[model samples]
Target: MKKLSNTVLATACCYSSLVAAQTTNLNEILVTASRTAQSVDETLASVTLITRKDIERSQAITVADILQKTPGVMITNRGGIGKSSSIFLRGTSSKNSLIVIDGIRVGSATLGQVSVEELNLSQIERIEIVRGPRSSLYGSDAAGGVIQIFTRRGAGRLTPSFTISAGSDGTSLAEVGLQGGDQNRWFNVTASGITTDGFDAKTTGNIDDDGYHNQGLHLRLGQRFDGGHELEGFFSITDSESEYDDFSSDRSDTLTKVMGASGTFAVSDMWLVNVSAGRSWNKTKAFSGSAFKSRHETVRDSFTIQNDLLISDDNQLIFGLDYINDQIDTNNAYVVTDRNNWAGFAQYQLTLGKSDLQFSARVDDNEQFGSYTTGGIAWGIPLNNNLKLVTSYGTAFKAPSFNDLYYPSDAYGGGNADLVPEESDTFELSLRGKYQDVNWQASLYQTTFKDMIAWAPSPTVLYPYRWLPSNINSARIRGLELSADYQWQQWLLSGNLSFLDPEVRSGANKGNRLARRADRILNLNLDRNFGALTLGATLHAEGRRYTSDSNTSSLEGFGTVDLRATYQLAPAWQVRAKLSNLLDKQYQTISGYNQAGSTALFTLAYQPQ
Candidate 1:
């Protein structure tokens, strides 16, 4: 059957190539990384793109799964889908990475990081990742990298989709979605539910009988006036109940909801205004016989206004201001805290000689941490028609979280109000060249951090015997990345390689590598297009890494391969089959957890005209 299918697909491709011509201009892409609509190649940064086809082939369920495919990114997963997870970029600590949703920062103010597991992949249109510091464009917590997620926007008329799947771990999931409404007004809505008896807990030596269940609903609505003005609103609500294997692994049932609205208006031919506002609420409750307990309520609200002005034929200026208010009510051993923040930022772009230069600056004021300023500069110079050299330098800062400032401690918890914010300076340079049918890019960067905060054992006369948040004098990180893509008449080959070195330069951690950071990572992708059928394969390699701050525990890295193929069953429907971890390599990416091996996934997609 396989040989027959291959021959048929090849024959169809030959026929199509003889009758149709393909154009490269039709492949142009638009992105919002610089807060503007620009072609992908025009952006002067180290960017990685994950397309819808990639997502379908991977069969990912959450944002983390997709992010892990990008070069220079490492993800730590505690268990199955929807479990606790954190992301690291170029050997930077997990908290150093920032997550943005629809251009807004959504990371928890107290945890110092957001749960990427909380984001569903079903509604995402695309994900754009900019590696390295971007504090010049975004503010604090942009040290490691910037991840932006773009949700589905209605295209034409009302369209809907549904999917159901059951997997190895006794996992079952169902999802339904609807989108579209003409060209001027449209809306997209998605709802999903999942339940699992769960795979066995390797540690406890038996199947996790407790299992878990989760349900979520999401909606996005947009309207455009006849005159070219637009308004958009989005909301997401989720609830979950799950069980833990033991006291150490226990977790609380959670309920989370978020609602937001944004709009854009064309004030004149050369000026445009954009505004946005939103709110979020999170609640968690612990079950009986649980060692970890918390009944916390968090509410976040913010607003932003931006104005774009055309200074001249070669100059453009964008000025913006924003305000945020956060409130937390918790009855845990970790203390309660409240914080309000306000910020204003401005960015300017100019065409200078044979180069394009971008300047940006911002200042943020926190009620508890006072105020700080951030700034950055980006320069891009064309070496020729097919090559460009880009470089950028910026400063970023991260304020202390509620848990960092005020947690209670008998043995396992505590707080430090006197804690200061962390700051870092970053510099990066890169070259991108596109010639004929081949395109390639390479980049190098370094970052230096001051007043790095970490939980350290009390020295001499501290009250807590175990740990306390203290400032480390300095930390240093450096990395190099190379990516290339070659396209032939019927075959495409792409690969990326990254190397990172992160170390503690001062304090008790001097010479120790940062925790959960992989020193090297590599990925390669191959695709062969045969008319309405395409065959693809991917290989990933990860290097050994440490799992603890003390560097006492380690995990040996491993390699995995994935194979997939898509067949156009009909004009409107396509079927795909994928085999993940093709070699069935059994290895632990994390210290105490085992990754799934040799799994198969199949998907069917339909498009109606």
Candidate 2:
């Protein structure tokens, strides 16, 4: 199908043939990039789990609106849905993506990258996407994949909840929550707030915010002893203020503050341990001219440990280790710099016979780009009883940020500390099937990148470090992903299709077409359940994209439709309504930026006995 110009985003395609009609109790299905508690067909990669009743039956409020309806994911919004979003998996880039919450690492290492529009899913409770190249278990932006988000904890009994919402332009939202605990101990707490007034700024907009304000707070705690041994603790805080219109001429403002903490332990029966730390403090103020002002700060810390040994009954062994540290401070409307980093890692997983295999490798050494190594392999097969086959290969590396290495602006564009670190090699293949109520999946992918950094010109400066950043030996990308889900008895239907082909296989912008990527994307979802009433509808299609970097104007191709309804007036109470985009479909997948035509939301809930 020869067509690639970016477009390989993963996160969609789930339903392991309902693992043969789930007998339930898969350890209650909860995973944070594999800490343990297997079963999602016993994981070997390609994972997607979204719950909270699939985020309130797809009322999706952020995290790029539930990753644009999951499935071999692809999202390109430059406006609305929490504004500015970018992600691409199989096809990579978005600064080689990697995001985590709960397990920390909420992106942005000095705007190095990671923006799903600053996450907000009303304190997410579930979301796990790990498609490929996990940087051998997470090390360099996971080399193009990894999206974990697990909030809400505590289950059964004790409860408290609250919600508020308002629609259209001046949008508004509020939330409050509390969970329960009993056998052992558990806790879940949440607080949220949002405000928006944006829209109408045309001229290939990038945001002159008609308005913006955000707030967040969360906590989760758990403990258990008396044999099973376990402990957990987590915390989060976020704040934001926004208004800016990326390209040239006029208004500005951006402010952010973030905080995080994490802890996890399980000392017996196949050891497991985790530790996390985070901090993000950002400030970008500009009121008039002098081509955009600047101010920055960043701090990060990480640690991880793992195990799952059992060498018989069809082999089982998994091992792990990790560490990360980063610190940055900047002020470069002129000059000011301080950068720091350190990394360490290891991984492996194996299980044979019925099929299950995995291997991860990692290495990160950077005092300023030096030392690199990353590895991957995955295989899962069981081609009978309903078909199944999977394959994977990987390698990843990235380094070059801090405004791409020091910033100085004339309307955003500066940084080049002799940039380096940007490498990749990825491959994938898949096929899955299930009869009975229909369920299917298909996948194919390819990625190749070498020293593919960005920004360049320096041959001895002249009007912008002569514009320099370097590294672009070659580039290549390919993709295909298809998904299907069908269920009876209560009706459930799903669909997803994506295709991309990226290029720039050499120098001088080799073959062009790779900025703000998009080759083709599609999504469809429908759900219905007569009795307690649950109805849903969704459709999003995008294709046609290009935003300079030498791809030329062009950002058309559009389609949007959404409608939702939920009712469960008893046993805890619930009532929900939503209408987004409806027939208002205006377009722009990225190129100047313009999207978000219609919107609406409503909700009510209660539970107590």
Candidate 3:
């Protein structure tokens, strides 16, 4: 694998016995890249897709479990299931990434990040991950990238699915779902529950087992009207409690909800229009030893109107307008708790001979800040029959979160209201091609961030030592990514590798590395089908990373292996088993936080054929 390429960074082994399709299918259509449908090979964006079959076959319990294996994606969790989790795409901060479910942006406005650990995979049908800045399409938080999740939808005749699982540490899961559809209408509904008595989350904390439980429901409905028009609605909710080893058996209860509706109209042969609106809420309550600590709730509302026009067979245009409002309600009082933003964007795509070009730009008027504009251009050049090169340049910006502006003064630290938005520019180049039974991609990219936020010590007369948030540092990051997929007969082999260098360019810690971002990551997967049984194995490894901006404490790198098998009992019933961390390797992505050890789980599932 070392001979493949120094900059090549991924090995995705998802498609073997789970489904017959190969990972390298160029015809797969994508919607998140440009807010419109386009084939994978035709879109000039780095993208990865995960299907429902892959999720089922992998037996992953959480959405983060599946996303961590993709190309140029990294995940860091504080502890076991339901604990705090964060994502870093290409050495960027967690706040730089955006998470979308059913086209509705969802996260916490106070914390400036999503609770990805709470999202269960049973209700998701597909996922699309686009790497690189997408602020030209989505407003803020898309400076790193965008991950769009599509929930289950009905298609054919009525069908029912039931699944149950039991595992080590008193872990259990159960889910039931029903879906039906006809030519004119479709609907899907699901209910699920999962609980686990997890291991201790910290090495030096109280010696007691932590635990987590979650309950969820999902529903989707769609109808096709006359004249090629369509209307759709979606609703999802999750309630969960997670206990960890912190302030005397500390725990938190969270309720997350998202709902949305959309209407699409085909105005003419060359014109299309879409109108959509959605809202999301994040509510959390904390407790310490049966005593209520605090409560914080975040709400987000979004609306959009878009038009797609086809000028010719080789040219297309898309323009859209978006309005967003965010509010926060917390037990701790703050001076300001709400803000609004309005934005307009347009994109153009053109093809000439063997060349492809795309231009996009957007302007956002934020209530907190004045106005910011972002733009991007991507070009594809044909090097030969088997290979193509892509080059792109983009600029992105991120607005400060509520906590960064108005957290209310505290003894330890306080927010700064005069801080400005952080900005960045990126340049990328890649080569992609297919040979024989193998498909591969290699790329290099660089990004520079200006006016980045940092927390620094601010001494006061009363409080000798204190900290405050300020726009102090700038950063430069350079990275390489490589991916390849191969299929031969009934076997599949896929892998990914990423190498990154993230450094503070203009600060006291000038040459120091960013916190919690591993410089090296590698993953490989292989699987085969035999008779009525299928077997697969995965290997994942990471390099050491710092835990503080000053690079005092660091986490050591470690590797783990996972094994899985599926057995068919009948055409509609099946049994599956998985052993994670087979070697019982002890490691931590966050200092003092303990990761899961070796564990086994068995599952029984039934679905109509």
Whole-model Cα lDDT of every candidate shown, in order: 0.71, 0.66, 0.85
> Against the true structure, candidate 3 has what lDDT?
0.85
Candidate 2 per-residue lDDT over residues 423-518, each given as its tens digit: 787888888767777767788878888878766434343343245566788788787888777877788887878888888888667788666566
TM-scores, all models, native as reference: 0.89, 0.31, 0.94
User: Among these predicted structures, which one has the highest TM-score?
Assistant: 3
Candidate No. with top lDDT: 3
Question: Ten residues in a row with the worst lDDT in model 2?
Answer: 4-13
TM-score of 2: 0.31
Error of 2 at 321 (Å): 17
What stretches of model 2 exceed 4 Å from their correct place? 1-76, 82-84, 87-120, 125-133, 138-141, 154-168, 187-198, 201-225, 229-359, 362-473, 476-508, 511-546, 551-589, 594-609
How do the residues 121-183 of candidate 3 rate in per-residue lDDT, one tens digit apiece?
A: 888988889999999989899888999888888767999999999999899999999999876
lDDT of 1 at 238: 80
lDDT score at residue 181, model 2, on the 0-100 scale: 81
Q: After best superposition, candidate 1 residue 366: deviation in angstroms?
A: 1.3
Candidate 1, after superposition: displacement of residue 111 in Å? 1.0
* Collision count for each candidate, in order: 3, 14, 12
Q: Rank the candidates by TM-score, best first.
A: 3, 1, 2
